[model samples]
Target: MLSRKASCDSHGQDSSYFLGWQEYEKNPYHTVHNPTGIIQMGLAENQLSFDLIESWLRRNPDIVGLKRDGESAFRELALFQDYHGLPVFKNELVDFMAKIRGNRIIFASNKLVLTAGATPANETLMFCLAEPGEAFLLPTPYYPGFDRDLKWRTGVEIVPIHCSSSNGFRITSSALERAYQQAQKLNLNVKGVLVTNPSNPLGITMNRAELNHLIDFAIDKNIHIVSDEIYSGTVFDSPKFVSIMELAMERELYNADIWNRIHIVYSLSKDLGVPGFRVGMIYSNNETVVDTATKMSSFGLVSSQTQFLLASILSDKKFTEKYMKETQRRLKKRREMLVSGLRNAGIQCLISNAGLFCWVDMRHLLTSDTFEAEKELWKRIVCEVGLNISAGSSCHCSEPGWFRICFANMSQETLQVAMQRMKAFTDSSNSAVSQQQFVNNTRARSLTKWVFQLSSYESEPHR
Candidate 1:
């Protein structure tokens, strides 16, 4: 194992990027003081809170669907007579989760367990499922949090499957098999596979048949499946989102006639648009897995208030139906707008069939240093052009040149203007090779200025 010092020297202070929580907590007020923090993708929720919710309610009064509010389902629990019996409200919440999720084949029985949100749940799963020497496989241009959370917490080996440009950032079973073969050659522990459906950053989804192949591979290898289904309900294209758990259930029922270990994790943060709620759930059929996760986290339970709110919202079928429809409509439109704009700008992106983001590949134009170059582009757009979007470098384990542009939060007009600014920037960058050369030439200018100042001081001979 590399010493922390050696790792620090190799990776440099870039490791500081992973120290997000404690560092942010220390000075979050700074961003508040700055006020110009427009369209930050770092935080999970809209800052407007009650006003936004109320406005959403007013604009579409009939859109009572609360598909994203995990706590909203529990609102009706208040009317229940007792907490125990044939129909305890909490039990209903559990059963409802099992039913809706189970019907989808996300019932990993013992393999699945719910957590506060994807982060802790993911970190816990990585720790539990992966041995110190084992390899955990994730797609390239992956979720940034998964890489950070895994390494920071468990120190396990991470294997990334880089999807090619021809494939549109989509991972195939062949890709997994190749990764598996590579892992075997390296003699890696080859513990588990982590995948996100309707993926983050890329915004693409896998079909049922595709998912089944992956599940079968995991089962055959006797390895665990870590499925991040946070965006499961946010499908934009046809075929919908098919889950590995559902595939596992199907395989157990027909193919293998035996249970396979697959773990599915979801969070209310994305779908509910109430990221602050910080509620997450995991599901699996592996008893040992669930038992271990519960023991690790059983010291505390989800907040009673949030749970009640989720219960209220979820049980309201009429509300959820309407909400989901409108949400999907808006998401689909926004995705189209962004993809179209990116295409017009000559920037290539993975076609987002589902989810709230678009994965933009900018390697053809620029390379990211600590992904800072991509962020600088966003800052330029935000500052010079009054536009805000996510940079892709934050999504993957490898140093990525991609940017994730989110369409869920911005107004249409703002999005259009942002796209125009981005187009202009790309065009200007292409035409302005001299600009970079000039900046490089100016590196010694400051030193020259300092030398002149020292000469002036020597002549003066100050006391």
Candidate 2:
């Protein structure tokens, strides 16, 4: 039976106050101290990636930190605008945009270009492009933002192309076809395909050859392509990162299909490891789309300082190359360390090539809802063993039995310690679950009473 706190909302929607006022009040503590946030995984980005900006500042240490209210970074705002033929006082934003007519960067295209970050970019693109009845296909268990961003921002329908543990959570062309076919039968208009290279939760980068097939498919269907290449420069141990832009740029020479229609959205944020800098580029040969996005930007306004800082950084080739290599080296080491730990503990991890995340399967233990398992898992880690991870179910995939671990922010020692804590938590959970099953056997009893039992899992084997 539902408890007094489990009553419906004012709208008669069911809500559960599982924990009392004290536990609810302590929520922020649980979230902030959690390993996912605190453990220093490499996912948060590195300062080394922004060495260019730092170097510039060091050279001009006397420069004032002023809020620049301006229109374009290319001319009036950017440091190297003059080098790129931008006159410091001239209106070169339109001219700079005109130079690149079409873009081929996967994950960084016109359909979904730059916005503070990929999240808003995805939301705006889907909102503007997806018609009232259109369906946007996403890989199951992908990024969480895709689900929340689209839902809260637009009225378009979402059609998930489910990926499963059996396939190692890798999405395939066949899956795309099936989702399209199903949407067609349901009279859903499918307008575009959005895929994340080195996907957020999965960390699986599609092979270039397979990407070509996808491009061909989109071309034939006349669907827009939104490739999230925010992680574009992060691929490790793979063939050099290949983009749809290279192929699209090539194809445009002969086919109207490849012309200024494809869009590319790139950001200095992720690869540069400076999310706070918030500088991203939208490249499109399609004048109509680029013009539309620019108009949108005029209303939204770009921070002049951010633009200048980014332009300064991008102008330095040596600075960019050095940082990129260093970041890759560090991330590679972290990935290996995490993989080794998981393996030693008998947990399975899908190895990723060029990204900061690894998607792990816990379906056997989770069995039901991915989100529910993650919610429980996160709590267990925080209250029990002091470990944390991004719940796999948060990404709006069909499955929630998986969890994603980010390697972008942590030091090696910290990661090892956190992993050990997670291992201990695993043991504690197993022990408590066994005992709780007996307490839950009674039909009339409230099984949730045992949630407190988890505190024992937290306090015992004291860290």
Top-lDDT candidate index: 1
Candidate 1: Cα lDDT at 127: 71
lDDT of 2 by residue, 415-459 (tens): 777778667655666677777876667632554556657777888
Cα TM-score of candidate 2? 0.72
Lowest summed lDDT across 10 adjacent residues in model 1 is found at 80-89
lDDT of 1 by residue, 1-463 (tens): 9778455533212432233323334433222473333433333332212343555456543224432333343345334322121222244345444443435542322343445677777877877788776898887767666656676647777788766656676677888888888888889978888888868767777777567766767767777778888886677577566666566555554444234356777777776577767677666566676777777655334554555456555666666556656666777877788789988888877667777777777766654454566556655654554444444654553544666667766557656766776788788876686687687668678778889999998999568
Per-candidate local distance difference test = 0.62, 0.58
Total backbone collisions for each predicted model: 45, 30
In angstroms, the error of model 2 at 198 is 2.0
TM-score for each candidate, following the candidate numbering: 0.72, 0.72
